[model samples]
Target: MTPPAPNIDPLTTPLERERVLAAYQRACAALEAAQQPNGAWAGEVVWNPMLICQYVICSHIVGREIPEPRKQRIRLSLELQRKRDGGWGMHPDVPPAPGDHDHHPNHDRDPAGLAGAHDSWMFHTVLGYVALRLLGADPNEPLLQDVRAWIHAHGGPYGVPTWGRAWLALLGLYPWSELQPLLPELWLLGDDSPMHPRRLYCHMRLIYLGLSYLYGARTQADASPLVEAIRGELYPEGWDVSRFRATRDQIASTDLYEPIGQSLEWLFAGARALSRAIPAVVRRRALARAWEHIEFEFASTNWVCLSPVNGMLFCLAMWSRDRRDPRLAQALQGLEYWMWEDDSEGLRICGARSDIWDTSFALQALCEGPQIDEAARAVDRASAWLPRAQLRADILGGREHYRESARGGWGFANEHHPWPVSDCTAEALEALLHAEHRGWDHAAARLDLSDKLAAVEFVLLRQNDDGGFGSYEPRRGSMLLARFNPAEMYGNCMLEYSYTECTASCVRGLAVALEALGANMPSELRARVQAGVDAGVQFLLGSQASNGAWPGFWGVNYTYGTFFSVAGLLAAGLDGEHVAVRRAVRHLISAQRDDGGWGERYEGVLESRERPLDADQPSRIVQTAWALLTLQQAAPERGREAIERGLRFLLDQQQPDGTWPHDAAVGVFFNTAVLDYRLYKLVFPTWALSRWLSR
Candidate 1:
């Protein structure tokens, strides 16, 4: 039997029970309306990683790590998803769990077999197995058994995923000839053209850049004994070593996120046919360029690299290039950042760090009122993360390394990416400054920087002359370039766009930076402030939909955006009493279901699905936080009773653990999928409840 989920249904007071039921009904109705075929349960997720992302996040916050054992359990879950027939699917019901392994799957005679029973791709299966294997599961483990059996049950190693083969090539399980070569030799090709790997999505480019160099020379490890053993079991007829060349271009339906353009395909085919010879000097130069990029990513990111997957692969890539490399050594040593541990699972790597991103607002919300106890607790967390997350060493590699100056910036989770994400740095700095204001000592010792204001200065540089903010970096490319997005499953990754949440965070950071600088701020600082305020109002006003909603680019939906945007507007001197503001407030009120609480489906975040919204969908704690914050900002005198009722709903919902239960996802990206901002459950309530206490 499976372990039971924690008790999530909190009991409520009499009045609060009625309120909770009403809100539950409201949100449930909304979700029911938003359902897709089967149980895909997509409310806001766009890139299709919503549920998977959530499982990773919730496990981290609760267990405080992604333990290897937990990862193995995830593998079991994925295995259970496979049908007896031999295929994987998007949802639980899609490719019904395999009914019988003995059943011969005849493709033409069995339409039902093809209906849901077919090998989708080995990529997801490979990822699932890797996660399980990392937990110490051997080749014979039930989960691996199902995966390997399914691979052979479908055909053989030749039926495996292209991406899976590529990863395995690095592991020495497969030869490089099987991969559609992402040649770093292409770096020898000029940069101005669209062929450069740097032109890909930030996430994808981060992975492929390191991979090309590693794959170009066909780097492979001394295969794990377990891996070699599994090679025999993974393929029937004893695994053909050369069949990969013929099947290299095979496309499994599930693996096709976007089709390669005919032009790019022709170029690749043409390259394969060509001699593909480059001058020895050019090869040296290209390898040098690749090394520079690899080192830059390592230095800027403190050898943490972008994601754990890439971070691990890049570690191997660096080792392949130079066996005695110090950068490679640092990456290996620092691998613990991604390695999470728990009692159930000994050790499992995290998707990324949560403590930094989670702890920031945790500190600020705790500081809002005079809850000195909670404030001190949050202070301790921020105190521990701050000094450690700072970049004390100079960067080592990349084009930006040769740029004018180093911006002492921070990443989303620690100093892992050192990429100087403008808002992340601003938010980190603000959190640190708040910690200082709350009387916490800077726990990170010997942390001195000549670049004291480098991060804030970076923020200033990022601010447009008109005064708006964008995520990651400035808006450097065209939005029209989205048409060329090869990752069909994703949207809006080609360039940065100004977002209200980012703008609010940046604006608030500036206010704190001004305070930190004291009267030493240039006279121009005052001018900049006014310019920011003016530009911010215009951005906020223009962004508001005709229906009086501000579509959230990041969070679950409009309610999240409205709360932050309205708070920023009010902070910037916009009067809620104004007719437009009043109408927006009323729209928020009218949209609220009979339930005293508010709940917006993730679809509302991704697609701007405003209502006549749903009732009977239980109101989530995070949504309640957003609504309460909005109500507080709107300061709707007549609506105080309703707002107070919503407060009771939250108070009643708090668990003995001092946390609320996870609800439906509350974040969206690429405007199609939802992500769980699980931290929102804790931080938003802490901030909201603190506001109520102050009241």
Candidate 2:
């Protein structure tokens, strides 16, 4: 029933090629102008307002000197992000129309009537309220009072989420017994047990280790007058603390992204009872074991820990274990590595650094447009840095620390970032291989063949049984882990699942690595790599949605998934005329705007739902780049005109300073929270332009 697809050739007339090359030069020049002297291109990682508050509380707790200017910056961020009723939510709003910082005072008098009322979780609200008080805001300040009143309306600290309860208990505002027992003995679970800690997603497992130690030790901060004062403000009418244990399982409605089912609740209750009966010596051994694992994490990442969420919790736990510990001091100092400041948002934490991730893609994209002789210095610097950044050794304490083989894999952030993600590793390998295939002399930069082979092996180990790949390691836990997920503000926090984006990254990486190795590669290793690529290609073919779009795990939605899927298929030798490739090409063309741009809203990705293409939404530079690049890979012959139009859209949108205006969010996590990767605009558009010019 589908009409025969239009026939077209990507080969441009002389005039068209000239226009494409001009755009390519402009884009590359823009990136070069923006590149820093440090040999890295860093971009802002837009995160939630809760990060600002977490930094405030953690700095105060650790006795680190919080500069007055930084304090004011955090205050401004909270004030600007505040809802009409004086509350904060999961994400900040787009900036007030350029240059109009009127601070709209009279928006909504009733905090309950705010537009995103459900978006404000008790966890964030409680932290924000406390952070304000710590910054010397009066208890009776009208804004403070309104936020406090809202908290009570939502069941106060008693109804905070699981992580919030742990924090409040650590602050001495809540009783230790009120928390569900997170005993370290769980680490003793056999590998065959479904509940083994190693089976959890890397982030979740590491967070639990720190949390269980503090909980099992009944650790609480020393009593302070400020803590005592905030306690009164939070629970103003409190009388009997006896019922705290009874309310441990209670969660606020606003926080319920994933509800705890009855089975898990009953299981938790029985666990709590058993925890009370645990022998003191046995508990000591478990807590000691937990502390050692904590030490291993601190050593692995040089105290950056995985993400800021676990980083903050680990800071608190280490302080509890040994206040004078030098590791604790280093952890506090390293926190600044992820701290980002903006005039509008003030201060917040990044989800992770994007140095290697951004640079790898930048180099690979540049190879498509810029000659090695033209971007020589830039390419040499990046290539030199890439070798150093690759994980040359597995993490220390591999078995005891519950880490996977990381040698030659790339991390999401930087070398110091402990987690080696499958997609990040694949992208790193692909970038290096592509650069070499395009005549980059890796030997000139001292990068040897062994380095390339190790990267190939890393990807081979990460492919799942389905031929897809997960973010961190191969899948170890079942989806059934979701039932016990107590972090209600987010979904899919319990385990890592195979992702289309990750699978595609591996396919592309393997294909390029094999090409670069050629006959020089050992026959056995080449055979293994070839088989892996074949399986990955099948996975992509079978995973396509009926509508021809693929769902993305790490990016905004289907557009992101389809972009990677089509690119991987092309790299694996699928022809543009192939039915699957044609279907994908048609699917993307359907979403193109009249202006020849593409825009994908973050709402569908956040809600895990399908969205119709609507011209009503403004065009996004990032999505446009993704769509353009996919078209270039899947159907360049019939896609030249479309690609040209898209190129014009990007050129028109770029700022004179070489950056594109920040578009809609470019990334998402936990299926609900949205974050931004600021450099996506520059890197992807440049990549898209280069692809068109190459054709």
Which of the numbered candidates is closest to the native, going by highest TM-score?
A: 2
Counting only residues 3 or more apart in sequence or on different chains, how many pairs clash (N, Cα, C under 3 Å) in candidate 1?
Answer: 32
The deviation in Å at residue 480 for candidate 2 is 2.4
lDDT tens digits by residue: candidate 2, 1-695:
01112222345577766665666666677777666665556677776678768777777777776787888778776776665444666644333211223543322222111233354667788988988888778889777888898898888888888887777787787887878778788876677898888889888898898888889888787788988999998887773567686777678887767877898888888888889898999888888888888777777888787888788877877887788987777878768778888676677778778888888788878866647344556666677677677888888778667788988788888766767877788887777666666556356564578878888888888888888888888888877887888677788878877788999988888887787678878999999988998999999999898888888778878889999998888888888998988998888888788887986665667566656445455577888999998997777668867877888888788776556776566687887677778788889988887776655
RMSD to true structure for each model, in Å: 10.6, 4.5
**lDDT winner:** 2
Query: On residues 258-310, what C-alpha lDDT tens digit does candidate 1 reach at each position?
Result: 45556655655665554256556665676678777777777666767666656
Question: Residue-pair clashes per candidate, as listed?
Answer: 32, 2
